[model samples]
Target: MNRALPWIIALLISLTANGVMTGIVLHRVAGSPHVSDVVRHEHRHPPRDPSDAARTGGFNVRAFLRSLPEEQQQIARQRFASERVGFRELMLAAQNAQQDAEAALRADPYDPQAAAEALGELRARRFEIEAAMEAIVLELVADLPPEERMNALAAGRRRPGGFGRRGDRRPSPRDRF
Candidate 1:
């Protein structure tokens, strides 16, 4: 009986360990209630690319425009030719304007009036660049076929989430309330 007792105890311990592992696997696979919280936390403060802010601030508008469809590119070329306002030229002008503002600010950082004027000029140039890019995008998007436009919209809508699908989930803590 004493020998059998040791075997029985060992079997019970092994069974308990297996049960715990199985429960964890099942919890993860079954979409535990806390999965959404985990997902939200993981995405709450997503890492920002350093260039993203600058790109958004109109620095990359010309490159973005250049990457559009061939027809759109041609249209932009024609428009630029007519108006003598090429995207690259506009980008360079914006860059020069921003550099000038920065230089002015650096030269007289203590002067509030000069700083304000420089800042205002920088803002205006950024706005102008953004507006030009937006106009170009609108014109190009308008020229796309209806089906392609719908598909592009759909693609943009589905681009945000990193999860495999709506039904995907993650494991939760055992004491989840």
Candidate 2:
């Protein structure tokens, strides 16, 4: 035990020194620059402008797209591209309606009637756009095989978490929402 004693003490001291050096290096690096900004965790969807987000209404249809076979996906893309003008028009109409509503509200004295009319128009535009999107979705899937359609539907219900069994282990945050 005496022969090993000095070696053990030296080993412990070396380990302590190495640990202290490592901690100092970590502290210095963490404090040296914009570490928090640089070390951010990856997110599926990074922050985006509210207006840009409004384009999709938080409806992620990628599940359905990815579930489709390659040929079908190409067809769907072409179909969506063809409807680009319609989507753009709907977006512009909705944006203009919102702007009109805000302008009416900010008028010398708020014009409740004008604001209400603008909001009503906005709502209608949103519904119209939603319907158009639904139609496009239907068009995209119409040619898909039954199994593929089922896969896409499955993907759609699994965004935040799978809309699986009622007796699931735990409720997802989306469930609370």
Candidate 3:
């Protein structure tokens, strides 16, 4: 019995260390938010401004349109209607590609190639959408007076993480213009 005493103690110590590490890892995994929860939350509480102009990254065209006189707004709408339809179609395609990429990433077998291709397509779609938005913004701003054009351009140039680390708190001083 004396010969086995040290071996048994070593085994017990190893098991205890492993159990502690496993528990820590499991606790962290359980505490983190699930992907679906985030998506659901976003869907449940959509952004206040539903316009595509607000959603796109640059040149707050919608705000500029809002600032215009009623007659000008109608002219702007007419100028934008055809382009808007194309932009909407592109956005829909990008959204679908995003879904496909997510599915590929989460598949049981997890085919990396499939995920890569889906992500590539998603990226291309995003580029196309961004280019379209830029073109639209440029076209809209071309006819604007200098002061209004500057205001429209300035509205889109915001700090990336306006909310900082904590969403509930206000943005940091650096984020404010």
Candidate 4:
């Protein structure tokens, strides 16, 4: 027992060190740089008050649909009402499922076969969630008035552009040259 004490101490130290290193690496890798930017930008450019929508001719699906050609508006209203889950909710569910699977894998890293099976199930569930989201969005957008559909597409594009006008601003001729 006395001779084994040193080996036991070494094993504990190595395990503790490995756990700390793994935590640090995981935090860095999982941190969302884009989400931080979006939060910062929102603070800087606070959205117009909800009440201002009427005056600003801002895009509001319900309002836009009400104003669209009656037939188109009716279809859009029906489509919008029929959607089961919003895009954001579906994405969140998929992410949660993935995180749960990762946590399970971490808890039992020694069981490769079990981990692989868990991972496969997680992936399949994620795909299903994403497909449901896509179907919802497609169903809603498909029946929307053409103008409203265009507006929704444009709004979605605006989110990524917040990171940089890198999306729209063409490269200067000098840079190309």
> What clash count goes with each model?
0, 0, 0, 0
RMSD of 2: 13.9
Instruction: Judge candidate 4 against the unseen true structure and give its global Cα lDDT, from 0 to 1.
Output: 0.59
Best by lDDT: 2
Q: Say which prediction, candidate 1 or candidate 4, comes out ahead on lDDT.
A: 1
Q: List the residue pairs that clash in candidate 3.
A: none
2 against 3, candidate with superior TM-score: 2
C-alpha lDDT values of all predictions: 0.62, 0.74, 0.70, 0.59
Candidate 3 residues 1-177, lDDT tens each? 699999999999999999999988996888975555467554465533534444545444444555555555566677677677797899999999999999999999889999999999999999998888777667766777888767655545432334446553553453212
Ten contiguous residues minimizing lDDT sum, candidate 1: 168-177
What lDDT would candidate 2 get against the real structure?
A: 0.74
Model 4, residue 157: distance off in Å is 2.6
What TM-score, over all chains together, does every model reach?
0.42, 0.54, 0.50, 0.35
The digit string of per-residue lDDT tens for model 1 on 11-99 reads 99999999999999999899887655556556366444544543333233344443456667677667655645565676787788788
User: Cα RMSD (Å) per model?
Assistant: 13.3, 13.9, 13.6, 19.8
Positional deviation of residue 12's Cα in model 3 after best superposition, in angstroms: 44
Which regions of candidate 3 are displaced past 4 Å? 1-60, 68-72, 158-177
Write the number of the candidate with greater TM-score, choosing between 1 and 3: 3
Candidate 1 lDDT at 150 equals 60
